[model samples]
Every structure is written in structure tokens, then in C-alpha cells.
Target: MIKPADFDFHFKPDSHWQWVETIALPFAVPEANINGIVYLVTRPMLGVCMCDVTLYDKITDLWEDQLYVDNQQHLPCPKSLTEFSLPNGLSFKVIEPLKHYRMKYEGIDETSFDLEFFGLHEPYDCNDPNMDPLAAARNGPAWDSSWSGHYEQTYRIKGELVARGKRYKVDCVETGDRSWGSRPERDNASIIWWHAAFGENLAVHFFTKHDIAKTNEFGELVSGYILEDGKVYGITSARGSQEYRKSIPIGGQLEVTDIRGKTFEFTYSTTNCAYWAPYPAVTYLQSAMRVNHNGRIGYGIQQLVLSRAYLGRNREALLARY
Candidate 1:
């Protein structure tokens, strides 16, 4: 169970290091065959806040994305029961403690949404004993002590999104994750981060950390749960591989085995490329994908990050091999 205490900000005001809080909401409109994600991130230590809204219009095979960033000195502190608003009309508020949240945005670029998220399952703590030892160790104190804690919970989102004058009802399953404490500076070691929610019943989140020079020596951590028929099963272990076309991720397969030994295999194909944001050290691709989990079709987002040096080496190796 998630208590209100869990929502408290874990960083100290006097700490001059770094910290971040993010709220991600992904939804699909089946009737219209459209999918989208609203991502909000705040780096309190840097006094920066950003919101990225991406919508995939399948009928036209087009992606519309708006990214808004606020780097002012008066950025709101991330705390329980507080609100954050941007000049672009994006606002986030905690309505009912740890169980409910509201997100609204009125963008000038023909993108807007008003959504409410209600938690559907108990929060799964990444540090719990139920996690795989190897996975837990990677996120443990020895790996990155500044990574204080992490937890995630699935939510059923309700509301609407308007893109290009078309309003679509937002009714789907999404997950909200919180990771606090000191965040490391962007480095070559951060390879990729993946997240997906299968309706209201299952969610998966994981990431790989590896040195750019030695990809063979990598550590992966997996955390999530399966909620079916009112029972929750913790994800014990997960293995996945991505297949890419050039720099874009086209498809991939994921196998997640729960503590009970029931494994779910998912085959996914990209539906739209949301954004490809490049940083000094890494390039990130966020896209919506059509996922088939044991024949039950769904839609989710696939976010990938490749270090610049690693990407160069990968391309070189491919050329030499071919």
C-alpha cells in the first residue's frame, strides 16, 4: 500500500546536488486509433521544469509533439499538496494525497489535455525483498548511493485530449513513477530506460547502465507488477531485446516472468516516432508502439537512449561487419 508519506519530497532544500521528479501519462483512444503521452519532469536542484506532449495520429501516420521548458528561478518546489504551473498553461496538482493526481495543459500549438489519474494498484517499491537479487543489487547503495529510492504504481486515467481541434476521450491505463534523491550528471554509462503499462493489469519498467567503452559489462534493473483479478504478482525477472532500423527503434520483444513463474511475452512494433532529442552525451527516442502481449493487443511508449560514443562505435562495427 502507498501511504501519503511516500509522496513526500526526499531531497533537502539545502542540498546543492541534483534531484528530479517526473510524472508520465500515456493513453490510447481506440475508437480513433490514436495514442499519446504527456510527460512532465522537474529538476528542483536546477530550478527547471519541462512538459512534453506527444500525440500520434495513426490515420495520417503523423506525430505532433510540443515541448515546453521553464528554467526560471521561481520554479515551484516539488512537494506533497503543492502545484506547479508553467506559462504555457501546463499545470500539475496533487488532488487526493497519494491516490489521485490531476494534469492539465493548454498549449498554443494546437495541443491540450485535462486528465485525472487514480491509482489502481498498491505501490511497488524497487528496494523490496521480492525483487531479483541481481536487479536489486544494481540499484542498491553500492551502485549509485545518490539514487535514494524508486517506486511505481499503475493508474486508470480519465479525461480528454484535443489535438488539432479534434477531442479524444482519454480512458486507459498508465503508470506514475517516483524516483528521488541525488541524480547523477548525464554520463556515458546511462544507456537506455524502458517503461510500459499493459492496460490496468500489468506494468513493466527497467533500465540498463553500462560504460560506453565496455557494453559487455552492463547492469540491468527491472521493477513492476501484474495486477489480475484483484491479485498482485510482483515481477521477478525480465529480459528484453530491441531491434532497430538505423537510429530508430522499429520493433522489439519482451519476456517478463513473475514471481509465480508465469511469463508474459510481448511483441511490439513502432507506430509513431514521438521525438528524437539529442544531448551532448546521449540521444533519446520516445515513440508509441503497438504491443501484442500473448495475443492481447495494446499500445505503449518505448523510450530509448544511446550514448553518443556508443552509437558511433555501434555504427562502425555494423559497417565493418557488413
Candidate 2:
């Protein structure tokens, strides 16, 4: 369980040790042929924040508009992570520890939003001792370097967004994650993080250790949980792989079973995607996806991070094929 103290910054003597909180919200505007995502990452130790918002129109199959500010550095550090406003027009307040939060952003561009997140269940701790041994071991150094103290929760996000003279109502179910540990900028590792929700009662969040060079591989399921019928269950086993086209993820399928032996299967395809380089070597791709589970339509997001070293090593082959 996450304590109240966890909502505040956890700074250490080592400069590399840092705290991070991020929210990814996916929303749709009915009959507008538009779908979008709002993503924000805050790093108190570095005194910086990253804000990304993009709207994509299915009719054109292109990014209609975006407000992306990846480097907001050297700003004054907030005293507490739970409740504080940054100079860059970003503000966060916690209504309940590990359960609810309010986030707002007024960027220089025409994009801005005020959103509230309500947790569907208890936060899932990545460091839980009850995790499967094989999955825990597979996490290895990647977990040690950055994900040592990490927890993720699925939230029902509701708010409003205004962009380019248009207002859209936002109501969706997504995932938010927080972590504090030694995070180096240039680690040579790659991972796939994804979230899918069937409704208010069913949601899934997980991570897979991936090798960028192998485009057809499913990689290894390292950590995750399932929220079903108002209860949370640690994932016991999963079989899934992301489908890629020319090194870019287009869609994937997953069959995940929790500790209770209940299984859920779903597949997703991308509607829109945007790229960002948060760190020198960390190239990230965030996409809004349309999910289909048990023939029910739903919404979700897929985030993948690849290190520059992986690209540098496979540059020739990637260039030839892609």
C-alpha cells in the first residue's frame, strides 16, 4: 500500500535519485472523428516537467494539432508533490492519497485542460513480494535502475479540454503511474508499457521487457495487475506480443490471467501516435488506441520507450528495411 508520504518528493543525497509522477488520459469527442491524449511527467529533482497533448482526426489519419513542451527545465522546485503549482502553468492537488488527484495545465499553445482522476481500486505495487518469481527475476536491472519503488493505478478521468477555439468534453478511463529511484538518462534498455479498460469494472495495466532489434517478439511480462469487479489482483501469467510495422507499433493482443485464475483477453490498434525524447537516450512513442475485448469497444493507450543505443546498434538494418 502507498502511504501519504509517498505523495511528496523523496529526494536523496545522490543526484541521480529522483521522483516521478505521470498521468496519461485518452478521450474521444463523439461524432467529431477526433481522439486525443494528455500526458504529463513531473521530475522534482531535476526541476523540470514535460507536457504533451495531441489530437488526431481519423478522417485525415493525421495529427490535427498538438501542444508539446518536452523541456521545461530550471524552474523552481515545488515544496511538496501532493499540492503545488509550477511556474509553467502546471498544478496538481491530491484529494485522497493513492485514490484521487486533480491536474491542470495551461500551456503557451492553444491547448489547456483541467482534469480529475478517481482511482478504480487500490494502487498496484510493482515491488509486491507476492509477484511471480519468474516475472520478478526477468525484471532484473531495468527495475533496479528506475522502477524500484513504483506503483500504478487505473483511473476514471473526467474534465474539459480547450484547443484551437474548440471545446471538448473529456471522460475516459486510463492509467497513472508514480516512481522514485535512481534514474539515469542513458540506460541501454527498452520496455513496453500499456493499459486497457473494458469499462468501469474491468481494466488491465502491465509492462514487458522488450528488445528493439527483434520486431516480432512478445518479450517478457515482468509486472502488472488486473482490476476486476472492484478488486485488484496481481497478474500471475500473460501471453502477448506487440505487432509492429517498420519498427512502429500498430497494434497487439494480450491474454492475461490474474492470481485468481480469471483471464481477460483483448486486442488493440492505434488511431494516432506522437513521439518524444524525454531524456538524451530515451525515445518514447505514445499512441491512443481503440480496444476490442469480448466484442466490446473500449479505449486505451500504449507507451513504448527505446534507448538510442538500441537504434545505434541496428541502424543499418533498420534503415534498409524501414
Candidate 3:
């Protein structure tokens, strides 16, 4: 179970300790052949915050010359996560911990936003004590070895955005997450975090472990939850496969069984994709996808992280293939 205090920074004694709050919001302008993603990450442990806004023009279909990034470091850290404004013109105030939050960003070149996120359901605890012992044992090491606590929630976001002298109304449902612990830099296993929402009634979030070097292997589901109507169900079993263009993920499919014995299958096609490194040792493909569940369509995002060490070991053959 998650409580109000979990939203605050959990500073450990180690120098590598960190608290992370991050979100990726997707927006599009079909008439202009543009689909864009906005990413924000805050690490109070390091007294820094970063914001990145990238716009993808479908006509050119390239990530170059379409990026805006801002970072503020060596600033004062907020005592609590409930309310704080960073030097980078990003401010966050929790209207209600774990359920509602208001965020605003300014001072970036021709990009600014004021948004409010309302949780559709209570935050899902990734480290539930009552989870299946086997599942927990298989997944705990990957997460527990790095972070002390983590949680994810789906939100209905509403607000406005001003980009390059034009204003666009913002309204969408997306997923965001929070994690706090000692984060060391090393050869961590590869992982995929993704989510899809079909209106306010149906949505799913998944975090899984994938071995990128072996492209044919299925991902091992770590933790996930399904929001169907007014209820939320824990995912009991899941198998996932991704379609890759060389080493980058282009699309994927997920089949899952919930605790209530219900099943769901979803397929997603990449609408736009870009790569970035929040930390030097890690780089990930952040893709915006058009997802299909049954006959319904929705929007989603995929984040695939691969360690630099793993890439270096396979560099010769991987580069030759690409």
C-alpha cells in the first residue's frame, strides 16, 4: 500500500542515492503531420531537474533538429515533494499526495505548459507484500537491488501548452511513476516500461525485463495492473514480444491474464520514435505508438533501456547489422 509520505524524497546515506519523479506526455497535430512527446524528470537528491520536448514531423520522420532541452543543477532541494519550484522554471504542487498534482514549466525557449493530473485510480504499488511469492522472488532482485520503493499511477491530464508562439489545448491520459533509492551505475538488466489507455474506463501499465541481445526471447513481466471500468486488477501472467528494426523496437504485442481470470491482448505500431540518454551509461528508445486492443484504438508510449556495457560487448556485430 502507498501512503502520502511516499511522495516525498527518500534520501539514503549513500552518495548514489536518488529520488526520481518522471513522466512522458504525448501530443499530436495530425494536420501538420507532427507527433510530439514531452519528458520531465526531477532528482532532488542531486539538486537537479531536466525537461525535454521533442517534436517529430512525419513528413521528414527524423528526430534531429526537433529538440528542446533544459536542465537546472546545483539548486536548493525542496524539503518535501508536496510543493516545490525548481530553478529551471518547473514547479510541482501536490493537491493530494498520490492522487492529484499540478505542474508548470516556463523559461524554456518558446515552450511552456501548465497542467493538472488527476489520478483515475489509486497508485499501484509495485512492491506489494501480498503478491505471489514466486513472482516477487523473480522480480524483486531487479528492482530491490536498485530502489527501495516505487509506484506507478495513471492520470487524466488537462491543461494548455504554448510552443513556438502557438497555443495548443492539452488533454490526455498518461502514466507517470516515482521511485526512490540508491541508484548505482552498473551493467543493469534491460527493461521495458509502457502503458496504454482507452478512455477513462480501460487502461493497462506494464514493466518487464527483456534481454535485448537475444531478440527472439519473450519479456518477463515484473508488475502491472489493469483498470477496467471502476475496478483494478493485478496482472498474474503476461508474455510480450517486440518487433525490431535492427536493434530498435518498432512495435510490440502483449497478452496478459489478470487475477480475476480475464485475458487481454494488445498490439501497438510505432507512430514516432526517438532515442536519448538521461544518464551516460543508459540510453533508451522513447516511442509514441498507436495501440489496438480488440477493435479499439488508443495512444501509448514505450521506453526501452539498454546498458552501455551490453552494447559495447556486442558492438561489432550490432553495428555491422545496422
Clashes of each: 0, 0, 0
Tens digits of per-residue lDDT for model 2, 1-322: 5676776666664656355555455555434535555555666667776655556553221233333332454556666778878776778899998788888878666767788889887777777665433335554532655665677788888888776557777777777777766666665577888887877888888788777575556677778788888888887777777666666678888888888888989888877665655445677666667888999987777777877887888788777665
lDDT of 1: 0.61
Per residue, candidate 3 scores C-alpha lDDT tens digits across 1-322 of 7788888766654546455554455545433434555555556667665655565543122345444444333446565668877666767799988888888878556877788888888877778755422246654532654445677788888887777667777677777777665555577667888888887889888888887776644677788888889577888878978877766677788898888889999998877666656566777777767889999998867788777887788787666654
Model 2 steric clash pairs:
none
Candidate 1 wrong stretches, greater than 4 Å: 30-33, 58-81, 130-146, 188-192, 195-198, 202-221, 278-282, 309-315, 318-322
Clash-forming residue pairs, model 3: none
Q: Order the candidates by lDDT, highest first.
A: 3, 2, 1
Q: For candidate 1, write residues 80-147 as lDDT tens digits.
A: 42466776566778787667888888876576889888988667666666543344555363235434
Measured against the true structure, the TM-scores of the candidates, in listed sequence, are 0.79, 0.86, 0.86
- Could you tell me the TM-score of candidate 3? 0.86
Worst 10 residues of 3 by lDDT: 58-67
* Candidate 3 ranges beyond 4 A from true positions: 12-64, 71-76, 131-135, 138-144, 320-322
The model with the greater lDDT, 2 or 3, is 3
